[model samples]
Target: MNGPHDMGGMHGMGPIPIEADESVFHSQWEAKVFAMSFATFCNYFPVDETRHASERMPPGDYLTSSYYERWLYALELLITEHNLVTPEEIEQRIAKLSQEEY
Candidate 1:
């Protein structure tokens, strides 16, 4: 497979940056993404497909996205692809939530 997931030893990629004292999740949503991915995997989705989502992503995005972001991206793709939810439904939900009073 020529996907980004197979790009381990290829050249031209810069060195991995080591963050100093990095927390597990950069934001609350990232933690939620992790949990969502895990829940989906446990229920109906395949873990390999989730991992392969990163590979299937556009090359630039795959290269630039964070680990958890990749997981989140995978979760979104799988949910839509599997007919669990539609993109429009998710967007509407987000819009409704954004307009709600806290």
Candidate 2:
């Protein structure tokens, strides 16, 4: 039942910091996926045509943001759109994790 969208957080993987050029791909599908994932992580709706405007999230905000924060946000959008994970489950999991020590 789990998929890329189901992967709520990067956890121990740390930040997958993507650069502008490195982010772009020759294949349109790859580009779309990257854009979608990035936008989703940033808690922004994905837009196909206007990627520049869509991904124009604040700068320092990104630096301050955790990898898991970005991943969780994106997964939230993807799961909702694809009917993968329920909001109740998301909340429950988050609550459970919050009780644990880092």
Candidate 3:
């Protein structure tokens, strides 16, 4: 739906810089996120749904989070909405990995 995420035909935002010969990915994790998102789509998650999920983020988040981070947030939303994983399970796993293991 129409939201702040829709920035098309807007003003105030600066012009986009076109880089000559931009790399497909600026880092390894970007590639991983790209692959993971594609695989998730292959499993039947509609591409439009994914876009809406990502775009529905708060305006601040939508503006500040990087491209892959936005994909991840959208993926999380879809996964939980579709019951692929519970929020608690996701949080538990995040906590486990976030802690020091050494």
For TM-score, the strongest prediction is 1
lDDT of 2: 0.52
Q: Candidate 2 lDDT, tens digit per residue, 1-102?
A: 333323366366476666776533545545555665766545644444223322232444444554444444445556665676788887997799779835
- Per-model TM-score on C-alpha atoms: 0.85, 0.34, 0.82
Off by over 4 Å in 2: 1-68
24: Cα error in model 2, Å: 19
Give the clash count for each candidate. Answer: 0, 1, 0
- Candidate 2, residue 7: the lDDT equals 32
Ranking by TM-score: 1, 3, 2
Question: Could you say which candidate leads in lDDT?
Answer: 3
lDDT digits (tens) for residues 11-63 of candidate 3: 99899777799888888878987898889877969888999889878888888
Clashing pairs in 1: none
* Displacement of the residue 10 alpha carbon in candidate 2, Å: 30
